[model samples]
Target: MKMISIGQLAKRTGASVRALRHYEQSGLLDAIRQDNGYRLFDESAVQFVERIRVLLRNGFTLDEIRPVASMLAPQPPDLRTVCADVIALYHDKLDELDQRIAALMEIRASAGARLAFLEEQRRRGGP
Candidate 1:
């Protein structure tokens, strides 16, 4: 069993040291303290951190990933059920993103309209 130091793990995973510490603090990654008080991680941590990074890149919050992270633990309950729950979470996130896009579109349209009106007024010599 090869144990990697926190700095090595961060380098291998392309995550900043601060981010790795944040992940540990957020309960996303687990690390062990060496006798010398240095943080060490198992090789398995690389995969876990990669998964976390993927989720975050895809707009999943740490809160949203918590359940999924738990499911990835050594002994998880009912994988099928976990998959279903994760799918439901994705659906909810998708719905929220859709609503946000709709609102942004509305704002964009309003801004465009205002811009056009202002341009027309300027063309007509109005302040």
Candidate 2:
């Protein structure tokens, strides 16, 4: 099997070495430790790294991307191969985001109200 150094992988994939290391740390990618302590990776690592980048770009967090990232390793997912677990995950994420949005909207409204009250007090020269 063909293998390459992390630097080569990063260069070929247009990812920084730091980013590659981050991916490894996040468990989104893997590499082999050589005797000299250099990290090496299979040719397919390019595909996995690219998949991770695409998933992350689409707003999937590292934890959320793990399973989906491996679904079609070395290849991209296809609609035909879509499964229930992945679908459920998307639904869960959407639900989570909705809850967060509602909370943030409430905070925003509260802040706006306080700002308006302070501005009014300033205008009226009230203590």
Candidate 3:
């Protein structure tokens, strides 16, 4: 495998250097530190970065994508036919989203009731 510098990876993926650094920090990508004090990566990192971009575009957070990040290797598979791990991750994300939605619904209901009470008070000329 050809080892490429971080600049090459950033250029190939059109991801900013800062974002690549963030990926490394987030444990979503890996690199090797050269003696010259530069980070290097295998050429396959292009695929990984692309996959990360696509997932982010589709609302997959870095944490959510971490489990399957390395599975893509040099190429990403068709997501419609995902592996068991990916399927489980999807289900987990869905469940998390459902819980968030339920919580938001409750908050919305409370806010709406408060708004209605304030409107009634205003209508009655209450200070």
- Candidate that would win on lDDT: 3
Runs in model 2 lying further than 4 Å from the true structure: 76-80
Model 2: per-residue lDDT, tens digit, 22-60? Answer: 888888788899899889999999877887777667667
lDDT of 3 by residue, 26-58 (tens): 998899998998999988898889988987876
What is the TM-score ranking, best to worst?
Answer: 1, 3, 2
Worst 10 residues of 1 by lDDT: 73-82
Model 2 clashing residue pairs (backbone) = none
When summed lDDT is taken over every stretch of 10 residues in candidate 3, the lowest stretch is 73-82
Per-residue lDDT of model 1, residues 15-97, tens digit only: 99999999999988989997898899988888788878888888999999988786554433454354677788789889999
Pairwise lDDT winner, candidates 1 and 3: 3
The better candidate by TM-score, 1 or 3, is 1
Query: How many residue pairs collide in each prediction?
Result: 0, 0, 0
Model 1 whole-model lDDT (C-alpha atoms): 0.85
TM-score of each: 0.87, 0.78, 0.78
